[model samples]
Target: MDTLCSRMLLFLGLAPFMTLAATPPPTHQFTLDNGLQVLIREDHRAPLVTSHLWFKVGSADEAPGQTGLSHVLEHMLYKGSGKTCADEASRILESIGAEENAFTTQDVTGYHQTLAPRYLGVVFELMADLMSTARLHADDLAREIAVIREERILRTDDNVDAAALEHFTALAHFANSYRTPTIGWMHDLQRVDAGELRHWYESRYAPGNAVLVIVGDVTLAQVQPLAERYFGVLQKRPVPRLLRPVELQLPGERHLTLHRDVATPQLLMAFNLPGLATAKDPHTVHALRLLNALLGGADSARLPKKLELTERVLNHVETRYDERTRGDSLLLLSAELTDPPQADLDEVQARIWQEIEALRSTPPSLDELERARTRLIAQQVYARDSIAKQARELATFQTIGLPWRLLDEDARALAKVTPQDIREAASTWLTRERLSVVHVQKGGGR
Candidate 1:
């Protein structure tokens, strides 16, 4: 009934989405002699276009001392670059009615813009300048660091949920660069100077370490020349592959109870899992995606159905399993508790583990498995409706060592996920030893 209602909502204009076929669009992919890869997809549906520049460098690449350098450089690019200061960059784009922003993730830092198709050359020039001539001015670095520190206060220090996630992930991985937050520690940011920023930038921002994604209102015939003219001039140097520390094993179950001033308590559990880039079994990833959908949403979801129908202490349950990473990642399940809880937390944990063990032992019924795959397919269709998101998706795949065609392959692969695969994946990857649990406490209580 709920699934039917959701489809009804989709038909009633409450949901807008897209599902590109496995074939994808007619994208022209090529590389420059300077080592930059470019993907161009033409969409003449609108007069708008989005240009994305993805640097294949992120927090994972940062050494112990240079945490958040990728994010810091993202801010510095906006503070100003080359001769086009932030003001000038803003003025230039604003004059042409452009929307622009940049973000850093675990495996990639990307800058993007959506603007009139005619402004493609303009963006190319702006990005090319930043790529080569970023000033990393001392005053600018200090000011931005202050801005980021305040951001930290709001996002991590004051927000207990965010703080808990930080500590949870740190303890979860224990020994990899993934343990560090993308937003570097306040102390590290305080000490990072222009020279340090410049060094990180120059080393990672080379043409060899980048992918340019263009979609909408343009073709490669029109974009290739401008790309060459603006970006081709940059020097070609082999991108230094950073040493990636492998997690040989989880030492044991790790747990943290964070006490802070808050209105309610929350519980989070995560398991270390292989990423799409590094996974030995691709089928497990597809099965995991279906498994997350089946276990996360709707009244029928495993977490909610068991806990909620029984009227346990949980106010809500959410499970997220994103396999997009350059290395190991996680399958995370989190829940918010009803205040002044009536249920025993240990009992709740036991029940949750039981559901996991069931998945490992019994293959889900065919109907349930099909429902999970259907929801997964429908959501993907809805997620790629925006030209900007499409371009971003393209760049992200390349950055994470995933082929662009994987986007199309996903729908096809998801359909092939069998119940047996889910059982095996749950049993193999979601073991007790790989799990880390975090409890958020509102006050001074165990």
Candidate 2:
């Protein structure tokens, strides 16, 4: 994740005077009678268009026993639809020289296609068909469940680092639905039947609960009618009330340790924080975003600079935070031990606390602050170079109940994030009550 930021920082430092595009291609928005939202941006840079169909529901919307139902439904969509056989949609896309894929996250699930302008309507037709009349056969459900279980095994169960993160996240939140992994737990996958899947599809996969974003060499005139002819015709239905449980306040830091079969030792520290949509003070959100970059989002950040490079206390370190989420988010720091440890998690953690205390006590230098901001700006500028990223950014804002214009406000808001603001944010949010720590080492059971 830091690779792109590192490269951008290097380029910016060496170039001395490099400029990105001043303005992005104009974006247009409209809503259908059936309540489906559509946003289109015309980028004639290439004869290709990227379309993303996004549903606002994800793992966070699922009930306790029905964890991963949203992700499983995403899989079943590719299995078959009213007009296409199992995997036929993928085959059709391949035949048309198009690239297509789908993903499920904590707050959104999206299916996307990048194809020649001539194939725009065909892709929309496929997505609309899947939305309205996906064939959730019993046999397909059983098979896909097995596939999902295998996927969990590979992504979470077999990987020690990922498993540690999973356990940490679960312990971080008690009532918040985010405690559950997006791929879901192994036991939850075993009991999901076709009926439950069909119910989830019918309830959550409605036009009212979705957003369609198209970017590239396509005009609103060309895309709008295609959207109407396919997606507009689908009947809108009531979606389940998104009951995102608030995490009750905890007294102090929550800690856990897991011993797994791994050579490298791992450490994770997370501070529960409000995301963009949930924050009462938007400035704090932007400040935290900048603080993340200063701490670990970049190679030149404090964590890697002080610990990994200078002190040799750790070999790697990075921070993870997502402000686009619908509910609370985590400011996470993950690190691994050096080859022959002169320091353990206790020593590394103490050093980390010292750095945090430094930030809380004193503001960063103006030059250091500017570098972090520039890196974030470069990331946004690079993201706009891809149509898929542009579409996703638009859809994500819409899904999270924010206007796309908020993206335009980002640079201005981020620029206003003074050093004092960063220090204040760190002091206010990174508290012991909001913290969770996980330690992983080589061995058997905890």
Candidate 3:
């Protein structure tokens, strides 16, 4: 079970970074009187418009006992507001030939709508209404809890990869809020009644904690009046400043083994690394991303080519550097063992380490670095093809207190990384002392 879980983590860790090559629309940004930040990106290529509302709060902001408050609040936002009833917002949206949805992640919660440009005001009104006046009625809370429970079951319980990643994170950040699942522990959810949810909503869901992002066929001058009329008049509430506790730096490697019903062996490894916020650190995060690409990101990456293609000891492999929401991030490497014997597993692990050591000792050839950079750049260009992606990118940055301009900055940074930088990053951050390994195996020992 441990081995299988680790392999699953690897698969997820290496999922493609979507890219879009087409030129993005011209964007304008501003702040409302009540401290709500707004960004407008004008694109006349299509008559449709995308509206996104990003809240600064998410899973990491939740209080200790209220594990999934941000996620639960995301669902409840659509339940009812000042003038809308449970699910009525969806009905109205569909009636106007629009699509709308919301999602919550570790760092932010977002609500979005895409519709013909004419419906922009309607979209804004609906979003503003919900943001200021969501009603967490008892019956609605009760019904949605069941829905979310099922969602949790489907995502974390039924799916092996998801379960393993969740467990891996839990163990990886033992002292941090990131350790908890965003969907929350089932037990925690049971205790989150309507009153508790309402308290959470009142405290965190305020204009000061939000940002509005729009893309498609709208200019700053055109949308500013409507935005002011709809969103500006809301009374400001005193939102408490976020104070994230610092985590003690991990000094050495940590290992854990988990058992579950599974078909093959898996290994999950994570190493602590500095986050993107600290500029003086030489952008190890980006270099680690490049390292992940060279090691196991693509079909022809080192792990796949060596383990699956040549050695035939592993069926698949994956590696990634998670750009964290808060505090330090992680560089993860995961793999599946073809045969589950202890000796073989140990040997496979050694080979993985050997590959890392080689990369650390010797800079990648110009060709290898260029190829990985090209692939990464191509993926970024592809992800920008849709207005949805543009909106998501902006929301993600704003949610994490980063300037949306960082998107371009990151592209430039990725371009500037040298092969020597990759080697240095690997040696410094990917050291064995900073590593944690999780192995998933079958229930009974061999």
Highest TM-score among the candidates is held by which one?
2
Per-residue lDDT, model 2, residue 309, is: 92
Worst 10 residues of 1 by lDDT: 10-19
Q: Which stretches of candidate 1 lie over 4 Å from their true place?
A: 1-20, 242-245, 297-300, 309-312, 444-446
TM-score of each: 0.92, 0.94, 0.90
Tens digits of lDDT, candidate 2, 1-446: 37567656655662422244346678899999888999998889889899999998898888889999999998889888889999999999999999999999888899999999999989988988989989899998998899999999998998887888889889887559889899998999999978888888998888988999999998988988898998888897886665544565653689998998867788999988888888888989999999999989988999999999999879899998888888888899999988788698899999999988888888986667878877787777778788888898889898888898787667767778889998998898888888899888878962
lDDT per residue (tens digit) for residues 67-116 in model 3:
98889889888888898988888898999999888888777788889999
Model 1: lDDT to the true structure: 0.80
Model 3 regions more than 4 Å off = 1-24, 243-246, 339-343, 444-446
Judged by lDDT, which candidate is best? 2
lDDT of candidate 2 vs native? Answer: 0.86
**Between candidates 1 and 2, which one is better according to lDDT?**
2
Model 1 agreement with the true structure over 297-410: per-residue lDDT tens digits: 555788898776676668888788877777877888888777777565666677788888889899887668876776777766755567887887788788776788887677
The residue pairs found clashing in candidate 1 are 17-382, 18-381
Name the runs in model 2 displaced over 4 angstroms.
1-22, 243-245, 249-251
